[model samples]
Target: MTIAPRDLLRRMFDAAIAAAQPARCVPACLPEPPKGRLVVIGAGKASGAMARAVEDHWPGALSGLVVTRYGYKVPCERIEIMEAAHPVPDAAGLIAAKRIQKLVSDLTADDLVLCLISGGGSALLALPLDGVTLEDKQAVNRALLRSGATISEMNCVRRHLSAVKGGRLAAACAPAKVVTLLLSDVPGDNPMDIASGPTAADPTTCADALAILQRYAITVPRTVLEVLESGRGESVKPGDPRLAGCQTRMIATPQMALDAAAAVARAAGYPVHILSDRIEGEARDVGSVLAGIALQVAGRGQPFTAPCVLLSGGETTVTVRGSGRGGRNVEFLLSLGIALNGQPGIHAIAGDTDGVDGLEEIAGAHLGPDSLSRAWELGVKPKDRLADNDGHGFFETLGDSVVTGPTLTNVNDFRAILIER
Candidate 1:
């Protein structure tokens, strides 16, 4: 029953992703058929899949629309699956956002609005507030992506700028009981943070968003600043009557995914330790810290000992300064590989559960004792690539990049370090 380190790591990663798939997690969370119409509306990388899951499980007729990243769409017979730009939203997303907002409006209390929310909804559900154009939001989104701001910070700013986010969408569905099913990809799994909480009441205010923008040095258009400063951009706060009928259910989460991965590792005869499912901070710094732990377990056996796998799940930020392909997971793996220094019997894999990291189609990469040696042999300077934030390029050249296409699920980043004695 001995398993190769690389295959074992991949299995654990796959298990983590499969555990969070909408088809498996969404049905139980689905609310009973509404007295009136059942309208499904959502936006995220996994929204398309979530819609399909709802279509398959519901007994009565349901119709709706959902927006997903360009390549993340899943076919649905009843619900319309729309494709849009992500990370930096485009005109398509703006149009879709307006349409989604309209769809949820004008509903009665007897009607049910089933909102499917997951990661990436903030950008996919882009509908800039009045006085702020889509281009303005795009510029701010691009800057925020490169600013090394945590997801929460970026989302806080987004909530203030968007017309649909920060519980505005839920407010639009006023009088209709809004039931939201979420697949959490953020660090804390806060419903308000997922997809900027389009269907959940936001406790954050315009002041909080403005402070995040100032802290990150992210420049917004004058109109955006005016909205925030004038308090016009404030979100629907808690206890708002518009959101009184709203309810949220976390269908899948990072901790659940991590626990599933741990089960696979344990059944394969390796003890597993999940450090944290909410770890955050800079990608490289997290990698370095994990490397230190792996080294300790591999050498001194002080913590969990060797012949075990360490698992963790959480999103990490990368301050993109280099003009190279960058994904937080790949950056993490590259940094982890370098810090390991080709230590024997230490292997790791890091990938985004949704199968895309940053802007790259690649999920993430793998690291072994010879990852550095292989890069050096291929004339690739690991340190230089790391500095340039070119982890995708570094691993792609070595044919070690993990590509899973669109996994149709996101529980954030998954990292596994295997220490074999």
Candidate 2:
């Protein structure tokens, strides 16, 4: 049976997401039950699912709270699952953050604090420092999101301004051993970068956050700037005594997801090439570069020949210069389609594993050899939409948007390009 390019690409993407589901990855990473209480606390798009996995597997009594995106909650009787905004901080997040901090306070050495962290926790675990208000954090988050800054850079700034992040959460749980199970969604899978390392020590300093703000030309509230300038926002650094008993386990990662997708391609009888699970930069620029590689394979057959699939996973940024709806995955696909210029026998799919791209609930989009022509027929100017930073708008109009709702897992963005002769 011959598999269509689009169907094969979708299957590959689904395989990637399935490999990172909390139920599949969290159970094995659960730490041994503590001598005393087992308290669970977490924040992320997948925290609810992670908490559920723990409840289903834990032998002892466990009770705690976890905050996730508004629509990403999974039912858990023991672990309270709270919903909050993502990609931006909100009052609900602030309240949850405060409650979460309080839950870990005054713990005993025999007790265990299990921290389940994943992508979007930085915003979901929103607790500003003394001088910084919730409003200030929210504003800074907006600025950072629009600044085209890398995830690590944005998270560095976030850690300095938050009271619960940057190892402070772990510090608060001092005396109680902290066991962090991470579903890494950032490039390189640095524990500190995942959810700004709420339960992990931070090596970055206030100066680094300040420099990032200046580099991105992002202006923060006066209180935010004051906190950074006065060094009052310093996060717990590595080697802190409070973090000595903390342990982090990366249960899922982009490389793992990419490998899963590669397996699907191999089983489908197509040779697979995983470019890099850590690709980064502006979405459009990366799309163009990948298109060049696909073109090379399609025309010259130099790099692995034809009838192959190119896979990559990473977080991409968008400058957001236009007024249209934007998603990095859609932006990438739009750019790739424009570069391909309707070239035959080349098809691609790009989507966030968590079922969201940019601020939209839609996962991402798909592109084919006729994508550009179809857009023209629909009176949609691909370049114009790309200029407007409206990849979601462009793809949606062409009926190519990939909507997966909430996959209950996140390992960053997944991209697959299939080339056939």
Candidate 3:
């Protein structure tokens, strides 16, 4: 059966999303009823869906609060789902963070704190340290995001500045078994990095957060600096007594998403090639390199012949040099288009698997051989847009941004394409 390249590309992306759907991942990882009370807590874009998953799978009296990004809520039987600001946290997040902190503090040794953590939780569950207000945290967070810092580095600073993160949430539930069900969105999938590791032991220290701040050249108030320098609110260490019963289990990840896309490609009469699930570096550079590989396959039939899909999953970083809207996925596509120079019959799509890329509402963008031509007719100039880091804007004008709202689950970035005659 012959398949259109665009159709095959969509199939690959859809399969990736289906594989990482929260409904399938969140249910089976839930813990049974505890000996005493069961306290459910979580924060992320997926927290709402995770809460709903737990309610459907676990049959017991459960009560707790979870914070998710606005417009990412799912109906839950008992767990309270609170909508908060994401990418940049807001006042709603501040209140929810305090509430969850108080909830964990009330836990007894016999109780079980089932903590559901995923990507975007760091900004969603915002409880700033004493003397450091939410505004302070917000300022720092906003700067770090565009500083080209890796996820690990950005999270390192976040863990130190929060009252609920860096193991403090687990510390509050001392004596109670804190079991964290994590759906990793960050490469390396470090528990300490996901949502800043709210219920896991933190290996990063206050000094480390300060060092990151220095590396990024982020300027904060003296009070915020003092709090970090004093080390008064350091997170639970690896062997802290309060974390003796804390545990973390990864339920979903980027590899799983890549595998799913690969399956679709193979079944669609195309040779599947997975580049890397942990890919990272500058977004535009990654795009240029991928374009080279596509050219090789399309022109010389090297790597893989026609009717092959190249797949990759990983977080890509973008250094903000322009005052325009930017997302890693869109940036990649814009760069890819420039490199390809409208090379015929090489179609592609690049997007965040979670259905939101960077700060935009679009999940990602889809491209065809005529994408540049369509974009040109739409008055889109590839070089000018890329120079401004306005890839989202470029795609938006061309009517190519793939907006799926919130998929409510994040495995990281997904990139796939079909090269054909």
Candidate 4:
């Protein structure tokens, strides 16, 4: 075989990235040329790249605004791309989100509101719900990050407490037909989970959002809690008439990317197995579970024959008991490597599809037999690093960090486990 293990891994990663290319994913999903004005608005790490693709493909005159993470900006004409805080919202996000809402306020029924949404959108598109202060929202968001809630559940809370989430944005375009092209970073590709369903209906209720908050013990200002309890700022429901004309399409997803990677693996004569596209929960715990499965396959070959790859994708959370500087992917890899205990003939990779793991530039990390021994030789303790909540620093020092810059799209987490015969 011409493919080395690492080479095959690189090839698969490349395929995954190719599957999520904004230029291709965005253009292919473009709706037919609408007769009316085409106003482009979006938010996410990939929003800038998606906007540029829209500008290049759509023959209609397009103009609008979008917000993206600070370093994930791309060039676009007519549509303004604003940079903002990610994984957390700031004044920049607040301002840009407001601009987007204002831009659609007066749209006529004939106009087309093309919303380009992707991962990181929830933070980049932050516009607190009426009666809730931005500070209040920020505090709640920080709490959620530490609460170990899944992205969908966290978004459930955000959707009900936001001015633009849960179907409100689509409602804002009222009468104007809205078509959302989404590059899903959320698992399950549930339109409702993509950036909190800015252009889709929200099946969750204020009561649901409140339940999530209570489940995590995320305390909020008394006024904010009252608003949720009172349902004063509840999101638009699934059957709301305003969303009747709204249409959404998943232009990209974790499964699509994983399928692309699997294709590469198959071409190389390696057997492949995909567990799921929507696995959830704490990063380390999920890693342990995957490690257990890998061990079963490697030892007894019950799950698959030797020389096979196990793949899975989904978003995971970190409870943040430590002060680590890593995201869930890195944490997962760390815990997974430790669980495997440097076992021979097994290696793995875990990362976020957006080229970022956690809040760092590292896409994720790789594991091999020597990984654990090497850490020990260098005076690095896996448990210590994991406890500090700093997977990035640990992996960075070991030179095992997978940094791919910004792939400009997010389909959430990607994991690959390889076993040699």
Give the candidate number with the greatest lDDT.
Answer: 2
What is the per-residue lDDT of model 1 for residues 1-421, given as tens digits with 9 covering 90 to 100? Answer: 7889999999999999999999999999999888899999999999999998998899999999999999888889999999999889999999899899889878999999999999999999999998999999999999999999999999998998889999999999989999999999999899989999898788888999899889988877889899999999999889999988988899999999999999999999999999999999999999999999999888899698888999998889999989887899999999999999999999999999999999999999889999999989989999999999999999999999999999999999999999998
Give the Å shift of residue 157 in candidate 4: 0.7
Candidate 1: give the clashing pairs.
none
Off by over 4 Å in 1: none
Clash count of each predicted structure: 0, 0, 0, 5
Better structure of 2 and 4 per TM-score:
2
Candidate 3, pairs of clashing residues: none
lDDT of each: 0.92, 0.94, 0.87, 0.87
* lDDT of each residue in 250-282, candidate 2, tens digit only: 999999999999999999999999999999999
Q: After superposition, how far is residue 10 of candidate 3 from its true place, in Å?
A: 1.8
- Estimated TM-score per prediction? 0.99, 0.99, 0.96, 0.97
Candidate 3 regions off by >4 Å? none
Worst 10 residues of 4 by lDDT: 1-10
lDDT per residue as tens, model 3, 1-421:
8777777777778788878777899777777778899999999988899888888888878899999999999988689999999888899999999999888876777899999898999999999988998899889888988998888999888888888899988988988899899988998888998999998888888899899889878887787799889997588789989999988889999899889888878887778888889889889999999999999999999888886888888899999899888899999989998999889888899989778888888888987778788888877788888989999988888778887778889888999867875
lDDT of 2 at 399: 88
**Could you tell me the lDDT of residue 192 within candidate 3?**
90
Could you give me the TM-score of model 3 versus the true structure?
0.96
> How would you encode candidate 4's per-residue C-alpha lDDT over 1-421 as one tens digit per residue?
4777766776787688789988988877888767778888989989999999998988778899999999989988799999999887899999999999999999888889999999899999989877788888888888888888888899998998899998889999988999999998887788988888888887788899889988988888876788789997688888899999888888988999999999998888889999998898889899899999989988998878888999899888999887777599889988998899988988888888888887787798877788889989999998899888888887887888887888888888888888888
How accurate locally is residue 34 in candidate 3, as Cα lDDT from 0 to 100? 88
lDDT of 3 at 90: 93
Least lDDT summed over 10 consecutive residues: which range in candidate 1?
A: 216-225
